[model samples]
Target: MAETDVISIDAAQQLATAALIANRTAPDIAARVASALVASEAAGQPGHGLSRVPSYSAQAQSGKVDGFARPSLERVTGSLVRVDGAFGFAYPALDLALDALPEMARGNGIAMAAVRRSHHFGQGGLHCERLADQGLVALVFGNAPKSIAPWGAKEPLFGTNPIAFAAPVPGSASLVIDLAVSRVAKGKIMAAEKAGRPIPEGWALDRDGNPTTDAAAAMEGTMLPIGDAKGAALAMMVEVMAAALVGSSFGFEASGLFSGEGDPPNLGQTIIAIDPGLSSGGTYGERIAALMTAMAGAEGARLPGSRRIGARLKAEREGMEVPRLILDEVRKLAGGQSLSRLD
Candidate 1:
């Protein structure tokens, strides 16, 4: 195994921020990206955490992502909001949507925001969790570069789309559910490839439709969906909600997110926030608590997000141990040394 280095949460954030700034990202934008990446790291999602900095910095420096672009918000209706990322990182666009959603949902009982021209938004659950923290329910849908094939086909057509839901529970952390349609996220395969490890069988197929343990081949091929045909159908649903409905590029139309040679991904994300108090007549808290109690009461049963919550708490209390190679790469980027490509 590769050597590892320990880093506190604050230090990790600072390092990531410096790396982005060195690669031409504005200070404010770099900070937002760093915060999201570090939070993902703390939550035990390494694929969406520090591992993304190299590619992100490369894209910013290459103009594939507009490092200095500012996102704009448009209130399409009383409860409908639209945000244009302007081909920038997705964090600022998502921030604007989250900031506007609470007031609109409370007033209208429910509200939705559609985001377009954005890049990857790490850990959709985090976005929904924010709304849940404010006593509102939230759902987030996002599309990525093509990676999964439609059922019964070798050619890839859909991304490993993700869906996340979060609901408030009185006197406790919110219930959060987040999952990628694929059997595993593409980032995991990328990580394995970077580590020179082979993936387990059934996770993906080679370009010729043969199952393979090679991580590099899997990246050039198709990711198996979570529930076979059922998962593919879910990915299609997300593609419509996040891309078609939002007027953004389809998964097949987007370029690789790991490389800096192509045009912007122009991805899309849709977030919906609902005011539980208005919908449930103020009984939401009690009802949710009862449901939580029943679920927790079951033998050998664990609540959703339990593992992630534990990981976050442990990271906060004891810092994180990051791979030494990844830390070195980040440090080099922070010093203004541009990499031609991360893939």
Candidate 2:
């Protein structure tokens, strides 16, 4: 197993950005992606954290990822925008979307962003949370490489697509909802495999369609949906919004992200931002707070994303723990000899 150790947030981002730069990724793009990865790590999301560095480096070096690609934005008249990622990392494109969303939502009461030719969007909710901080409710959907099969199918068709939403609470932390339609994210299986651990049996099935606990076999198979048919349908809905509506490749047409092979995944993401005051006459925040207050009053009731918010806060104050082996690999990839971590 990889030895676990603590590393400061700054060190995590720095080494991650350095490794990407060493692999020929543009500095700005690398910084954006590295920041997102670090945020995921700090939020207690290991599946989308430093474990991605090695694969990203290999993809960048092998031309499976266009390290120097730039995202471009176009206004689709009023209230709508489209950002093309140029088949690079998704962070730059998502950043462009976030930058353009607030002003449009403020003026038009609603706005939508369509991002195409993108790579993986590390944490889907983080993007929506940005809009929430700007006083807008945001819904975000992203399509990834195929991993989950549709309901009643043995063959994989739809991606383990994710959808996230966030709403501002006026004074406190925003309410955020993020979920992968699959039983769990495919990256968690990948993480378990890397850490030499087995996954839970219900998470995925073997290639022959039997449920398995072996992470390796799970990776080669299909991920079960969260709510049987319901989750599968939701995954397809997001797939259409993110891929078909955005003119990106479908999940079945995309290449695998695990290996440096085929064309770039060319995924798609769609974001919707709505000004709550537009319809609620500025009382939306208080209305939602009432429901939250009632829910919190119930015995043993915990809100969604509470743990993630707390985890992020603690990581900010106490730093993050990453595997030492992962850090060594990152340093080696970056051609750096230092392996020091700050307290």
Candidate 3:
């Protein structure tokens, strides 16, 4: 096992923020990104946590991500909002959208936000959960750089798009469902490679389209989709909803996100918030509660976000155990040490 260091969440965020600022990210933007990364870590998603600092910093230094860029928003209709990320990190843009969306949904009973020219918006479930906390049902779709191929062909064409949904229950924690179209997120393979570990065979296929257990090989190849064709179909759906609809580059057109060598990914994200009171007429809470009760009664049925919630609570109380290597790298960045390579 890798040697790990336990760090308080606030301290981790401080380190991340300092590292980002040293790498040319604006202070405000750095803070937002740091907060999101830390939150993802607390939720047991290390792939999107501190591990991302090196690449993100490298991207900022390379100008692939405009560290100083600020997002702008527009209300196109009574229930439609459009945000331009201006080639910046996605956290600020998403925060801008969320700040306006809840009120819009409450007023119009349904509100949709389309974000363009954005970078990665980590852990989409968190976004939905925020809406659910506001007494709204929320859905989010995001498309990334191409990493998955259509079911029939070998050449990669679709991203491992993610879909997230969240809904509130009368007096309980919101239910959040988040899934990646790929059998597993490519980040996991990247993490394994960093740790010199082999990935599971079924997770990815080599360049020749044969399944492989080598993490390095998996990174160079295409990811397997969940439910075979069905997952691929879902990726397409996200592409249309997020990229096509929002005038962002298609997955095939975007650059790789893990490197600082190419152009900005120019990804897109679409968020929809619905006021359940409008449709359910006060019965939504009761219905959701009943469903929850039924699931709780099942022998071993675990709620979708239950584990994540538990992880968050534990992290809050005991801090996070971050890999020592990763922590050292972030510390170096925070200390203004430049990395020769982000990989």
Candidate 4:
């Protein structure tokens, strides 16, 4: 066994890919999903990282997720696309959106893609950053498994829906903003539960509608909204934009994220891409630079996603660590292969 958990990035992806393949995921799709999970790890978002593999593999093996599902896309218009994930993991569906977005944006000035029958969208920023890399501004919205309540209610009616936006920053990294509608993402709470830790107050209320510091209780209860009623309203808006408008299941109708007990989440996501020049002629970058410059000058002002981007840089050089237990579990899923052999 490796003495330290500090694993190379390649090893992480390879381990994840092998585990997905063992669970019956198609080779290509498994690789894509693995890479996305590894990318999540690189971005300092462990909640969406490799820790997801055991549940994902279990779901795939149990037939709760169609490991071989082929995502299909249809253009409803020059500027709009509809994608069906065929009940697969969401990364492949997102790959379809990312692949199609730039060309559609160039042709139509703006383009939108609606994805349904999907699974968890690991991280919004990565999806948006891809389009931004193509010199277009992008927005990504995803509805997750339900873990939040409507304002003034105890029912978990909405997912901790996340939204992300990105734009090229001229000669620098893209400006990206990704956020969950809840006060804190439910994944963080789940991670805490796995680590056997208590959650902070104000993060959630137990099923009886009372606050609890227990992580497991928080998972069984309602996640507090970020800005109270405002976040609830935003979550409702996402329920409409990503689910109702896309013909996908509402958060309340979806199964639990960590379980294979019910139907597939059959969730929805929306991605919008726009050519910067469409709205700004040729001065979009200049306008953005001015705003960024001003923001840089403002006291205590820091750009959103700065720390996330920084972590990516760090992960690239120093790689990252995967707990020995997680690595062992995934390796076992991958035919009980040794890490040395798997890598």
- Report each candidate's C-alpha RMSD, comma-separated, in the order given: 3.3, 2.4, 3.3, 2.4
Error of 3 at 323 (Å): 1.9
Give the TM-score comparing model 4 with the true structure, all chains together: 0.95
Please estimate how well model 4 matches the true structure, expressed as its whole-model Cα lDDT.
0.87
TM-score of each: 0.96, 0.96, 0.96, 0.95
What do the candidate models score in CA lDDT, each in turn?
Answer: 0.92, 0.88, 0.90, 0.87
Predicted candidate 4 versus true structure: per-residue lDDT over 1-343, tens digit per residue: 2233777778888889889888878877888999999998889887788878988998998888999999999989999999999999999888888898899999989999999999999889999999998899999889988888888887888999999999999899999999999988888887666656688899999999999999899888889999999999999999998999899999989998887678898999999999998889899989999999999999999889988877888888898866566666777888854435433
Candidate 2, residue 134: the lDDT equals: 88
Show model 2 residue runs off by greater than 4 Å: 337-343
Clashing pairs in 2: none
Clashing pairs in 3: none
TM-score of model number 1? 0.96
Candidate 3 — which residues are off by over 4 angstroms?
Answer: 336-343
lDDT of 1 by residue, 1-343 (tens): 6677889998898889889988889988998999999999899888788989999999999999999999999999999999999999999999999999999999999999999999999999999999999989999999999988889877899999999999998888989999999998888887677666789999999988899999999988899999999999999999999999999999999988888889999999999999999999989988998899899899999898878899998999999888877888899888853333221
Poorest 10 consecutive residues of model 2 by lDDT?
A: 334-343
- Candidate 1 overall lDDT versus native: 0.92
Global CA lDDT computed for model 2:
0.88
Q: Output the lDDT of residue 62, model 4.
A: 84
Q: Which candidate comes out best when scored by lDDT? A: 1
